[model samples]
Target chain A: MHRLALSAVLVLAALSAAADPLPSWKDGPAKQAITGFVTDVTKAGGKDFVPPAQRIAVFDNDGTLWIEQPMYTQLAFVLDRLKVLAPAHPEWTEQQPFKAALEGDLATLGAAGSEGLLQLVIATHSGMTSAEFETIALDWIGAARHPRFQQPYTQLIYQPMLELLEYLRGNGFKTFIVSGGGADFMRPWSETVYGIPPEQVIGSQIAQRFEVRDGVPVIVREPEVAFIDDQAGKPVGIQRHIGRRPILAFGNSDGDIQMLQWTTGAPGPSLGLILHHTDAEREYAYDRESHFGRLDKALALAPENGWVLVSMKDAWSHLFPPTQGSQPDE
Target chain B: MHRLALSAVLVLAALSAAADPLPSWKDGPAKQAITGFVTDVTKAGGKDFVPPAQRIAVFDNDGTLWIEQPMYTQLAFVLDRLKVLAPAHPEWTEQQPFKAALEGDLATLGAAGSEGLLQLVIATHSGMTSAEFETIALDWIGAARHPRFQQPYTQLIYQPMLELLEYLRGNGFKTFIVSGGGADFMRPWSETVYGIPPEQVIGSQIAQRFEVRDGVPVIVREPEVAFIDDQAGKPVGIQRHIGRRPILAFGNSDGDIQMLQWTTGAPGPSLGLILHHTDAEREYAYDRESHFGRLDKALALAPENGWVLVSMKDAWSHLFPPTQGSQPDE
Candidate 1:
């Protein structure tokens, strides 16, 4: 009888061990915050809780899930392609945008602004079949290095957020990315990067055409764009693609304001968090005036909307690659 | 001993019944075709096969799965709304497109022609919150009837296709709709109509803005339109949304030619089936020259593409509302 009792205790312990919820998140307020939400939703006696089936947690791609600085990762690919195609198109030599792009001077490129940016993006993104674009994005992301960090562009993603995505998914949350990047560009590598499938990634879109070239069927990009997933476009992307307003939304820029607004405005339980770029030494810190990832409107709206603003400076133990280790306090 | 042997035979029969692949499909060519495909994929010796995970099936929503004749069900909806709102909007009587719409005159209403149709669709579709639009669609679908069919618009759907959708889903097929309709308009009702969730419904779209109106957030429609998912757009829709070429493609018109071509052109194994409208007595049969839902190019391409051109006159014993008690002969 005693032996049987021991066996029963062992079985109970084994089952408990097998069901450990989040093993990666360190024990703290951050972890508690997650567990608190999950426990309330999933626990038998918790009020203001959600059921398991409705456990939909959404993430922002660019800065929230991974890195989007030094311009969106796709734009980097476009810049590289601009270099490759510069010689073929001599018109680029005299053209204002292309000339600035070819000079490798980002300041001048910034001076040329959205018109230049649009011209560059359209030129690089168009003319390729969807399949071909996937190959190009994959190849560039695999080989391209950040100009400063010298690491592969993909390796610069936030480690804690990555852990958060997996932990949430492990808890039956359907993780999705509602980003302001091009949907096609993100869909190609989203699964590999964040473990979120292509279907769950929502973003901007360019119009494409279906044509048969030499008996081969291909979907080629048109010069026309369908939508730009920025600012107001973010909410539209979430509406058109995801249908469900996210139970949780994470963003680092003003562009993500509408997304947060939409997600939080839903009647039932929801979470809206902003990733504030506050770590000066570890990462760049500029708000309101920063051109690339402007966070002014989101900052102003955060308090009014009661959004949790994560001081990237304080919230994370590490920045990226995990192997590189955190930047020194200096 | 003889009684025991008979019981064993009965038990074997029961086991086979329990494990039967699909019981919904009738015992005919359609059934045979589906069974053969599954068998080839799962059988030990078949080379052209899919491992259950990669089995993605896409359907065109408008005509293939549901009725899209006389006018798209959504158009019928906007027209009904136009009539309802005509009284409120006094300006509608004097406006070019609005005046035409109020009079029930297609030619005059769309004096803008294609652009007029687009403007009407956009005007009616936007200006409301996502929830407002959803509720509107749900309410409209619940009560509205097709003008000529004298039945609820949703009731005009092809029952066999409905069964096929459920049947495929039961067998692990992830179904998607690559259509030419507005994505948001179809999505609000697709789940209720076809058991297809919004994310899986890809279609044409217009740009929308995320805004805070009177302290409440809403997605407002922009005047700018996006991709128009028709003809060549079908294949593009499949690529942009599904990311995988559907193994099985279905359509009734030449607008779907590029889709069939793209789906069939994918190497390895695929099936492209076209529904030929030939039963005028039961349902409308005019095709090839019809202003909308034309089937000429696809019909011509079927033979060389190894597609199955199904005759509505032959394949279906019943065309719609499976329980309506209307048999083909009757």
Candidate 2:
């Protein structure tokens, strides 16, 4: 009887160990805040209980789910695409942004500003069918490596955020990506990488036209920008696509401030999270003064707005999954 | 032992009777085609078998799911709104379309054409928060009745389509409403009527702005047409919203022709269906030359495209659910 009791205890221990939903997250305030909020909202008949269908959670993609510095991975893709397409247009060699992109000069590219970057994006991203664009994006995403990390851009996805996504989904929360990047660029691999489906991804989009190409229907991307899903545009995009206000919102930069405010500001029991890139040794860490993913206003407003600031230096034990190649030499 | 055998036979018989997915659909080519296609795509190891995640079916809302005869239900809502708001604006009585709308003159209103209709839509639909619009829409849908049927517009939904939606859902298919009508107009009642949630309904939308009104974030509908999910716009809308191409498409008008062609023309086994309103006695009759849902081009091209045309008179055992009020006392 004593042996049987011991065996039972061991089995219970094994089951208890397996029950940790966010195994990648360290046992800290950030993890507690997440699990506690989920518990409070999910318990049946409770004051703060939200119905399973209404448990909407939105996450900013770049910097929140993955790295965004020294520049956005999409910006890197645009630069590379500009280089590949430069030979066809001799005018590109003389163009300000295209010349900057072709020469691999980050300083010149920065000087060219958003308008120059927009020009590069439009020239390289449009004039093709959606299916063709999907193929090009998939091929590029598969082949491209992060310059600093020396790993596939997809591999740079934060392990903690992935676990958080799975944790939320397991609790009946429908997870969505409300990103500032192009929706088409993200949809190709979001499902495989983050378990979020294509329809759940709301992002910036260029105009597209549906036409019959050789008697077959095709949606061709156009040069005009239909929507820019950054800052205030985040909430607008979310409203247009999801048609419902999210209860939980996550972000890492000032661009995501409006989205967080829109989500948690609504009259309800809600949670807002901001990931602070504070670990300089393990990852790029520049806030308030950074060129890309500047976290000034959001950092200032976090405390007053009741948003939880997650310190990457302390909260995370693992930056990325094991399969993402070894860290680069400093 | 003999009694046990009898019980087993009775159980099997009961199971077989309950297994019929489309009880409302009469045993005809339309019903057979639906069942056969579902079976082909659901059976494991079959060449055409589709995974549950990939099993998407898009349905056109206006004419395919409900009665759009005489006029569209949304148009009726807009006209009603115009009248309610007319008391505040005496100038509306002097306006061409508003005057015609107030006097219940469908002829003059129709003569005012798309531009006049657009003006009415923008005036009535915009200048409200999405939440406010939802409440107004819900209240209107619940109270307003069809003139001919004298039943709530929600009750006018075709019984066969309801069964088909449930049947597809049972077979692991995700059903979505891809309508030309306003998404906000449909979202308030879609879940209760069609079992499709707000997020699953993709439709025409005006621009929306996220603003903090009285220290609360609200998405106010703006007075500009952001997108029109009809004709060529259907495929573009589908690509923008769904991201994945649907395997099954259903519609009842020329507006859905491009959507159907896009679905069936993809390199895979697909099904495109058109619901023909041929039963003048039971319900609507005019189709090919009708003002509301013109089915001219689709009818001519159905045979060549292998699109199944469902004859309402022959294929549906019941026009609508029994609770919709018997035959409008005709």
Candidate 3:
């Protein structure tokens, strides 16, 4: 090739290589906010520059990273677990909570309250080693499909959020999941789905004890609540697990408001974002009065706190990753 | 200069830069074990090779990385805290545990048992925001000096261990501190002294709650024990915090046997090491009968478990990092 032609080719390659880090995100304030924060923090000798070691970013799993509509995927997993264990526990067919869960009676289960929910959770989530629980969760996540979408739950992860995770990591930020979901439940598949290892995931947990059974050391789960990583508990979980205040935090509900507050409230340049469900056609759009992920308080407080609310309709070009056999049969 | 001379200079520079990764480590079986394990796991296409993402290493902080003799540095901090708060709590001067702690009566404190120790820990370790606690711990760790060594506790870190931490990181391994000390206490100075960040430090914790106090979101520590990261709790803590089983584990006491067992018992390549406090001249020596950092059962099980016993006397050429004030005053 001629010298001029080769120079032009090199220039073109460089420009394309520097193309949008978040192509799934629309060109809007939400994308700009993320890019701008990353740029300012990474530029050496700049006023807002943060060291690579201190660049910690936390994300919420259910609503923000994946679909939380038609009830949480974990709740679905628990309901399935209830059915699987029903044969072993003969009394479950007659019990109030277990009967409701086993029969797919959403109304009764919803009205069962936190106490009933806790009982169901303990029944389904405890009495096994962490390794065993992880195996069970892995198999379920692989086989189970979303009721409404007719696709695996892992397939419903937001494409723009995945791109954002990759972009932030490329910019020297360590990304973590600070979720209200069961840590063990999310851990088994998070690395495969989101490129986030289990060690970087922080979430609610049950009591666990380390014991040697048949000369093998194992950590067994107990029927006691260790923590609840929702609402105000989000910040508490972040402190307990990460040990450092996060520089950036992303969430979608009032459960995440304190986490945003804790991150952006720090004395440096920080970013806090909320993923608003506004694309009813592509995904569920209920927010303020929603039964699952309520967002009224956080939405109202976002402006004053300098937390950006990312509109799904305007911000994202795609809803999820393309999956084979995801289309309904004709 | 001649091309041959320049080539020779370049070769010399390359060889010097690639010298020993652990210079402070003596030529012994302990050093050989570390190098051999790292080589086998990191070599691509090798039978025992591990991927970079799965290369996890965990180290116990107290006895393995730094001085824990005479008394734990945290215990010393708690005693100082007792003295500082004694004026406020006149009644504590008469209380059994508090009286024993405030008066520096080690014999009486020893007689107080686990219940008494718990009382002391709760009194000093809770009732503040995590931010406030971090500040207090930072100040205490900075100002406090080891009584026997007459140097800051940070300066008393094992030189060979620090080299090992750096070497592991250089080989694409993520290193973490799994300590029995308070997570909040170790987090303040861990990054500065050990090059391991706060997010990578896991330890015992007290109950914490997030609340909006005076129009600010704060995570406050409550006066209750949440989880103890010691003995059997070591494996449980590793499971809860870092969900993946580590490929390498290091410790000095029985508290870490479960962690080592959990790591080495995994399917693939793994390594476990214990730092024996054998250098009585450079550092205090105690094992089976010591009140602090007792190492009895773990030592006996090391051979069967394939865990290497790193003799501090033979494995390390130096004890602690050199500090500006560490030299004796002439």
Candidate 4:
């Protein structure tokens, strides 16, 4: 009896020694809920559990993986691209979205809304082969700094979420980023930032044409929208690309509601988590009526679906790139 | 001395137990070549070897996994679709390729060439949603039987390759199908046929538009050519879908030449294999010049690229589905 008790104590110690990804996350109902589900599904003889074969977890990129505060990181990349390319294309002084971007008027640009966003994306995205776009994205992201943070846009990735990704993967989950951002745009940088390879990143895509341009058959960008991976489109992207409904889906806003709903609806050990922007001091906080990353429907869904609501105010110790003196003060 | 000999034998048994994917592949210089490389990489001490995370193995679907002799099973499915949908769209009688298909003169139908093929494909493939295409594929594949061979289209898959898929996966390689078939067509059934899920299958695709059709934003198919997962297009597909160069590539024809070359050139422990047709009685044997799956340039690249040439005749005791009986003779 003593020997059995000793073995049980040792096993508990071993479990305790396992690393938790989000160390700064407060041990509240949200944190408990996250760990509890992970433990139950991973533990042997647990009811709502899945084996390693089905250990695939998908995440939304924009708000979930990184800070999409003032603007989307990719769009910011494109706007910076327009500024760089604006010198060469002297005719763009009169173009619609490009013109607005060049002028740098926030209110006028905001009024243009999705149309302006789409136009900017298409203008910056098309007329090049996929290879060229990859090069362009790399060049812009490497050199350009976020307007508010004044750090490299890549540096603005969320700290707690990064740990969460590593955390899930450490516990036998194959984590993926399913975003509404352009697929190629995310593919080049995702591996470096999130450790999710290009294959594991599913995103919005425009139509590409295959033609022998200059003796090399290349996949060239087209202005047409191929698939929009936002809102209701999230489920379609997940269905089309990942195929399997993910065990865990995380996002911060109304844009991610469908993905959370789809994931929670899947009959298995699952989690639908929404990050509530309740902290304005350490990090930006806006929801419901907020223009970007609004957390309304998801906040409502939490109680009914048994979804975990991560309060950025309460849960995290710090926010917005925790690299001590690296990121500029907002 | 007796104990030493027993230990040595046990070590040899353990080594053989580890290398099982290509066990039936003939123990020639080719086989030794494969086993040696696999052993060097998988064993703890080998330099420039990939761990489990980097074990990405991609395969060509049509002739590599299943018989594409009579016609591309997908083409046959399309032809069947042409027949089924003909009565509904009599205007197709006025169409170029559909007119050719309706007449049943394959020589003339094929004579119209790529233009004719594209016209037929577009007319049949487009306008409907992706979900509709999947249902159409499922219905046709479940009921349609291949002529001459007289078996269900799914039953025409090679048993050896199926075993190989399972084996490689068991040893930590993520297998993907990079084929020129329509993505929707193959994705619907690939999971059932090859134990490969839809996400792992990359293929020729048409452009789609995201729009609110009847109050619901549906991804409707367009007649534009997206990326063709064939010939030189194969490498591009690999680059676009799979960000990393594949460690291993398998295909049966010259269409897979660039893919094989790309895989072989990957700077690590890599394998490139071509499935050569040599079995005359059980299956057709043509390589240098065949209508569909010709393997001339790729055959030439085997030695230069260090790719293994797998002769279907000698590699396996069985071809086709297991449920159809393994007997080679009537």
Query: Going through the candidates in order, what fraction of the true interface contacts does each contain?
Result: 0.69, 0.74, 0.92, 0.21
User: Top model by TM-score, which number?
Assistant: 2
- Locate the minimum summed-lDDT window of 10 residues in model 1 chain B: B17-26
Better of 2 and 4 by TM-score: 2
Give candidate 2 misplaced runs (Cα > 4 Å): A1-17, A325-330, B1-17, B322-330
Cα lDDT, model 2, residue B197: 83
lDDT of 1 by residue, A1-330 (tens): 254554454356336535534433345655566667666666666676665545777677777776667677777887899998888899988887888888777888899887778888888888888888888778878889877677876677876787778767776678877776777777777777777777777777777888899999988887777668777777777777767567777788888887888878877777788887877777667678776778897898887887878777767655663444333441
DockQ each: 0.53, 0.67, 0.70, 0.23
Could you give candidate 2's per-residue lDDT for residues B1-330 as a string of tens digits?
254554454356336536776766889899999999999999999999998878889999998999997699999999889878998989988888889988888899989998888888988999999899989999999999988888899999997899899989999999999999998899888988999988899999999998888878888999998999999889888899889899999999999999999898898889999999999888888787898989999999999999999999899866676555454312
- Candidate 4 structure quality by residue, lDDT tens digits, A147-182: 666777777777778777887888888888878888
The better candidate by DockQ, 3 or 4, is 3
lDDT of 2 at B72: 96
What's the true lDDT of residue A70 in model 3?
87
Isolated chain A TM-score, each model: 0.87, 0.93, 0.93, 0.88
Q: Could you list the CA RMSD of all candidates, in the order they appear?
A: 7.5, 6.1, 6.2, 7.8
* DockQ metric, candidate 3: 0.70
Candidate 4, residue B84: how far the Cα is off, in Å: 6.6
Residue A40 accuracy (lDDT) in model 2: 98
Question: Candidate 3's C-alpha lDDT?
Answer: 0.88
The pairs that clash in candidate 2 are none
CAPRI category for model 3: medium
Mark the regions of model 3 whose C-alpha exceeds 4 Å error after superposition.
Answer: A1-17, A323-330, B1-17, B324-330
In candidate 3, what are the lDDT values of residues B224-293, reduced to their tens digit? Answer: 9988998788888888998888999999999898999999888889999999998787788889999999
